[model samples]
Target: MTDVIVGAALVRAGKLLAQQRAWPERHAGQWELPGGRVEPGESEEDALARECREELDVAVSVGGRVGADVPLGPAKVLRIYAAGLVSPGDEPRAVEHSAVRWLGLDDLDDLDWLPADRVLLPAVRTLLAGSFSSLSTAQDGL
Candidate 1:
């Protein structure tokens, strides 16, 4: 099975970073979270970091796993994770994305996402819920 690494970067008060692919890229012109396949010999975390850097020119701080291993189509195992920007100023340079936006979780439904991500949405939602558990806990403290 094809092993793919996907990142969910949270930024700016809960907005999640999303990207529109550039032409010639897989799922070109569609919006999805930024990440790519794990290169041979690279760990998933390292591959994620490399993919983000190569595709967006922005550095990211890898975070906890928000998604479970998922099968996409007939031969793909997608590993999605929750991540954050290394710094708030690290806007995407979009090397492979034609456009990039920081989206709120509620807004994710509006985008035309890549097929793998589309199939992975239920898990993404559950993952985001897990990620937000901390926020809810903090808010309860407030």
Candidate 2:
């Protein structure tokens, strides 16, 4: 069976969170979503939440799947999901990455994303657009 790696498209306000890889000379400095492998017997959502806590020191509420499965070599595949902070006021820290940034729609394209993550931009774009609209609606109600 193929191993599944889950990525969190963690969004807040009108931005999406991205992390920069810190190690492995080949992938260093490249950006990607915060996530890790889904362990045996753990549901994808549970794994994602756990990963966020481990990698970002934040609690996330996993939502629906965001994009298609991206094949990673022969035995692994990447799946992304929409997620949000359990406490909207909470900030995420980069525990495992070199750095973390919240990228707006305009900022997404410029980052040097990891190969698997680059392909998911369209779906992430759609997700962020929706987030922007929701933020606008909420602000307008104020």
Candidate 3:
């Protein structure tokens, strides 16, 4: 059976959470959405939530599925899902990542996203607008 990997796109107030890789030197410093492979008997949404809790130390509400599946390897496919924090004040602490940042629309394309994840940027942009709104909203305190 094929292995399914889930990626989380958590947006808040015009910003999307992005995580930088820390290990396997080759992919280190490059950004990828926070998630991991789903284990046997685990649902995809559950896997995503578990991944966030393990990697970021936060709880997230998994929303709609995002863009097309991204090829991670011969056996893995990376699929992203839209998410929001269960609590606004619960900031994600990057326990497994080198760093974490909240990225706005203008800042999306500039980051060196992992090859598998870059394909989802367009969908991510759309998701961000719905959940976080615009730059003006961020300024107006929405």
Candidate 4:
């Protein structure tokens, strides 16, 4: 069976949270979403929440799946899910990453993303676009 690695596409206030890798020389300095391998017997959502807490020092509320599964290698697959900070005002610090940034739509393509993460850009774009559209509609009504 293929191992599952979950990624959190955590968005807030029209921005998506991205983290820069700090190690594994080949991938260091490249950006990717916050997440890690799902432990055996743990649900994807649970693993995502745990990863967020461990990697970002913040709690996240996992939402729906964001994109299709991406192959990592012969034995591992990547899955991304929509998520948001449990406390909207909470700031995510780079606990294990080199740095963390909140990226706007225009900034997404500028970063050098890890190969697996690059595949999900379109889905992430749609997620952020939907967020902005909803915010715009709500503001218009107000």
Candidate 5:
């Protein structure tokens, strides 16, 4: 089985959490969904939760995956899952990066996103759209 790189498409109030890279000059300043590689003995969910805690210092609940698995290398693939903050009062920070930004669908295209992360933008857009698509039905007046 190939190793998987997991990411969290954490959206709240119509915005998705994006973490900016601060290391490895090559990728510095690029944004990516918060996550990392799944360890040998860890399940995808566990890995995501662990990554979030380690990288963002916040807990999250993983939901259905956002996009199809993307090839990272011959033996590794990148996968992302929809997620929400477990502690609503707690905000994610750039524990390992330079910054964290919450972006709405309209602003998605403007970021200098990490190569792998940019691939999931379409799916992320779809997810964010659906998240706040609720419309009230008031046929009979209140």
Candidate 6:
């Protein structure tokens, strides 16, 4: 099976953005990170932005991959990104979600994340220790 690369964005400010799955979906009723399938010819950054807009109806500033659950060949790969809302009106619109909520990290395990994302839970916690995303070393000059 070809591994699908999906973007997983965790909105900060003491809460992780989660969305309830629509009925008949693979993970229906479960709360998962808001994102979508990466499109062809699109960079991960662009894909992340587009996915956020389509899934949550919000604009987000794409950040680094704080965590990634990439299985060996044929297994699915989920790239977890550290992103922030671009505006004050960043609340979810539920275009693709049944419901959305701001959840604390401690409540993460309570939600039913996809298998790959569940594996990345630990890494996500670690990244949360720092603020937002990391600045590129190359950008230290600026």
Top candidate by lDDT: 4
> lDDT per residue, candidate 2, 8-110, as tens digits?
9999988999999998989999999999999999999999999999999999999999989999989999999999999999999999899999999999999
Candidate whose TM-score is highest: 4
10 residues in a row with least lDDT, candidate 5: 133-142
Q: Taking the tens digit of each residue's C-alpha lDDT, what string does model 3 give over 12-108?
A: 8769999999988999999989999899999999999999999999999999899988887788788999888999899998899999999988899
- Scanning candidate 3 in windows of ten residues, the lowest lDDT window is 130-139
TM-score of 5: 0.92
Per-residue error at 13 for model 1, in Å?
A: 1.9
Error of 3 at 98 (Å): 0.6
If the candidates were sorted by their TM-score against the true structure, best first, what order would they fall in? Answer: 4, 2, 5, 3, 6, 1
**Model 6 residue 130 CA deviation in Å:** 2.4
Q: After superposition, how far is residue 59 of candidate 6 from its true place, in Å?
A: 0.4
Q: State the displacement of the C-alpha of residue 67, model 2, in Å, after optimal TM-score superposition.
A: 1.1
Per-model CA lDDT versus the true structure: 0.74, 0.96, 0.90, 0.97, 0.90, 0.71
Q: Which of the two candidates, 2 or 6, achieves a greater lDDT against the reference?
A: 2
Give the Cα error of residue 101 in candidate 3, in Å: 0.1
Clashes of each: 0, 0, 0, 0, 0, 0
What is candidate 1's CA lDDT for residue 111?
Answer: 92
* Candidate 6: regions farther than 4 A off: 1-4, 72-75, 132-142
Give the poorly placed runs of model 4, Cα more than 4 Å off: none
- Runs of candidate 3 with Cα error greater than 4 angstroms are 134-142
lDDT score for residue 34 of model 5: 96
Q: How many backbone clashes does candidate 5 have?
A: 0
Q: Write the per-residue lDDT of candidate 4 for residues 1-142, one digit (tens) a residue.
A: 8999999999998899999999999999999999999999999999999999999999999999998999999999999999999999899999999999999999999999999999999999999999989888999999
Q: List the RMSD of every prediction in angstroms.
A: 2.8, 0.8, 2.5, 0.7, 2.7, 5.3
